[model samples]
Target: MDRFIECWNGLDDPRTGNAALHDFHEILAIAMCAVLCGGQGSVDMGLFAKSKEPFLRGFLRLENGVPSHDTFSRLFRMLDTEQFRAAFQRFMAGFSEQCEGVVAIDGKVLRRSFDSASGKSPLHMVAAWGCEQRLVLAQIATDAKSNEITAVPKLLEMLRLKGTIVTADALNCQRAIAQQIVDQGGDYALALKGNQGTLHDDVVLFLDDPASKAITAEPVVEADHGRIETRTATVATDIAWLNKDHHWPGLAAVGKVERLRETAGKTTSQTAYYLLSAPLTPERFNEVVRSHWGVENRLHWRLDVVMNEDQDRSRLGNGPHNLAVLRHMAINVMQKDGEKGSLRGKFKRASWDEAYLARLLSLF
Candidate 1:
C-alpha cells in the first residue's frame, strides 16, 4: 500500500520531493508483515525477511535494498502514528461492516513496556471490537498514565453504530458512558463494580432485598477442553447495598446468582450479584450480560497468550498505535482466513504459507 502509506503521511508533497520510502518503504512493510507472521523479535524479522528473499524479490524492490534491525526500529519511530491510525480506520472500514449485535469496548496496557528505557511508553488503548461483526471497529490511545474513560467515548464516535450494543467493564459503568452509547444509537451492557459507589451499592441492595430473582434454573451445557459440563443457575437476592438516592438507567432488575456445576461426577456451586444495563429478562439479560466475559476470554486472552502483543515496546512516536493496529488487523485477517481459531494457529498458517501471508498484508 505505497499509496496508502503516502496518504497516511497527510502532508502535501513539497516541490522539493515526494516523501517516499525510497525502497526502504517496501523493506519496512515487508519486515513488518513478517513480524506479524510470528517474527519473534528484531532478529526474527530479519531472518524472516531473508528467508523470503526469493519471493520478496519478485514484488518488492529488494534489489540493492537491505535493512538492518535498527532500520526497522528507526523507520517506525519516524512514522506519524495518529495520522496513520486514522488512515488505518479508513482502510479497515470497508472490511468492518456492521454485520450485527453488541460491540465490546475495553482497554489494555502493554504492561511490560511501561518501564522500558528505550523511549517507548506504556500504551493504554481503548478498542471497540464488534463480536458479531468479527472485526475491530475503532481504537484510540489513552494517556499511558490514565484510564480510558474519555477515550472510550471518542473511539465510539468514530464508529458506525446502527444496531450495536457496546459492552464495557466496571470502570466504564457510569451514566455518561452509558448515555453516550444510547446517544450513538447503541445499547450498552457495562459491568458494575466498586468503582461507582452509589450504583454498586444500589444494585447490591436491590439484589439483596429478598425479592429480585433474575435467573431461574438456567442450565448451560457445553463441551470444552475435552470435558462436558452442565451448569444450573439462579438469581435471587437479599438487599444490603442499595441506597434510596441512587438513580439507575435502564435498570431492569438487580439480583444474585446460584450456580451449580456438575462435571466428572462432581458437583460444585457459586453465587454472585450483577447490575444489568437492560431490562431483567431471564433469557435475554442472563445470556448477554453473562456472556460479556467471553469477549475478554476470546480476544484479549489470545492477544496476550498467543500473539505476545502486550509484551512489546513498540511505543515510540506512533509505533504503539501502528503496531496495535497491525496486530488487530492481523487477528481479523487470520480469523477470516478459515484455517485458524487461535492467534498462534493463525501465525503458524502465515509462517507456513508465504503467499497467504502476502495476501494478508496486501489488504492493508
Candidate 2:
C-alpha cells in the first residue's frame, strides 16, 4: 500500500525538479505519518515526517527523499482529494464487498471551513458505511447544489447492496430511497419523523390507537460506569405496519419503538418510531439503533475531540478533503493494529514502529 500511494503520488508533476519536495511518495508518506503523529495540518505533517525519519525509514525506503513543509502544503493544496479518495476505496474494494449488514448513508460538514471567504468550496460528502463490518465503504462529494437526501440514491447506485440493510436517520426516509434500497437487494431501517407528512401522521395515530398491538418482545440490558448503575431497555414492537405492504416494493415489515431507561437514581425514556424492512422483533431494532450511535461517539466525537478534526482548516484546494480521508484511514489502521492501543496514543507508536507502518499499508 505504501508503494502504491507513493507510485500514485509520483503521477503528479511538481513543476520544479530540484525543489526540496517533488515526489508524491515522500509527500504522501509524510502526510500519512503526520496524521499518525496527531498532526492536523500540512505544516504539522511535514514537521512530523521530519521528526520521525529513523522510524519511517525502517518502513518506507526513501533513499534520499525529504519534502519541506511548503512542499507538503503546496502538493496537497493542488492534488485531487476526490481522486485520491476514489483510489483508496478501490484499494479496499475486496474488504468492502464482504460487509454483511446495514450500509448507513449519512453526511457531516467539515464545520471549521464552512465560511472560508474564498467562495463556497466547502466539501459535503455523502458516505456509505458498512455498519456491520465497521468500515467506511465509499464516499461521494455533494457539490454546492445538493444535500444528503438528494445525494443518497446516486451514491447507493455505486455500491453493491446485496443482502444488506441500508439504515439512515430521518433525513433519508424518502419513498424513492426506500425503493432504491429494496431494488438493490437490500433492506432498510429508516427512521420515521415528521417529514413524511401522511406516513408520519399514520404511524403516530396507529401506534396511539389502542388496537395497534401486533407482536410482543422485550430486552433487558445493564451497563455500569464505576459509580453509577444503569439499565436500558425496549418493550414494544407490536404494530400493523410490520405486516402491511405499505407500498414499499420489497418491504417485509415495519414497526414502532418504546425505550425505557433508568440511570443513576432517575428513570426517563421516550418512544421513537421506526420502519424496518425486516420483521426483526423489537429487541433487534433497538440493537441496531444503539449501535448506530457508535458512529457518533466512536468516530465523529473521537475525530473532533481526540484527532481535533473539526477544528483544522487546511484550506487548500483539495488539501482539506484529502487530509480528512487520510485521517480516517489512519484511524482504521490504528484500530486494527492491536498493539498500538488507544487512538490518542497510536500516533506515538506509529511514529516509532517501522514494521507497524508496513503492516498498516498491507492491511485492507
Scored by lDDT, the top model is: 2
Q: How many clashes show up in model 1?
A: 7
TM-score of 1: 0.80
lDDT of 2 by residue, 1-364 (tens): 4545643532454446555334556567667767776788877876776777776676566766666678877777676755676666665564554657667777766766555576656667667766666666777666443477888887888788887778888888888998888888888888889887777777777665666655535555556562332223232344445346256555555566665566667776666666777777656766666666656666667778888877887765776677777777777666656663677766766566666656666664
Minimum summed lDDT over a 10-residue window in model 1 is located at: 11-20
Alpha-carbon local distance difference test for all models: 0.64, 0.67
Model 2 clash pairs are: 242-254
Reference-based lDDT, residue 19, model 2: 58
- Which parts of model 1 have CA positions greater than 4 angstroms off? 1-21, 24-28, 40-42, 116-121, 213-217, 221-245, 248-277, 362-364
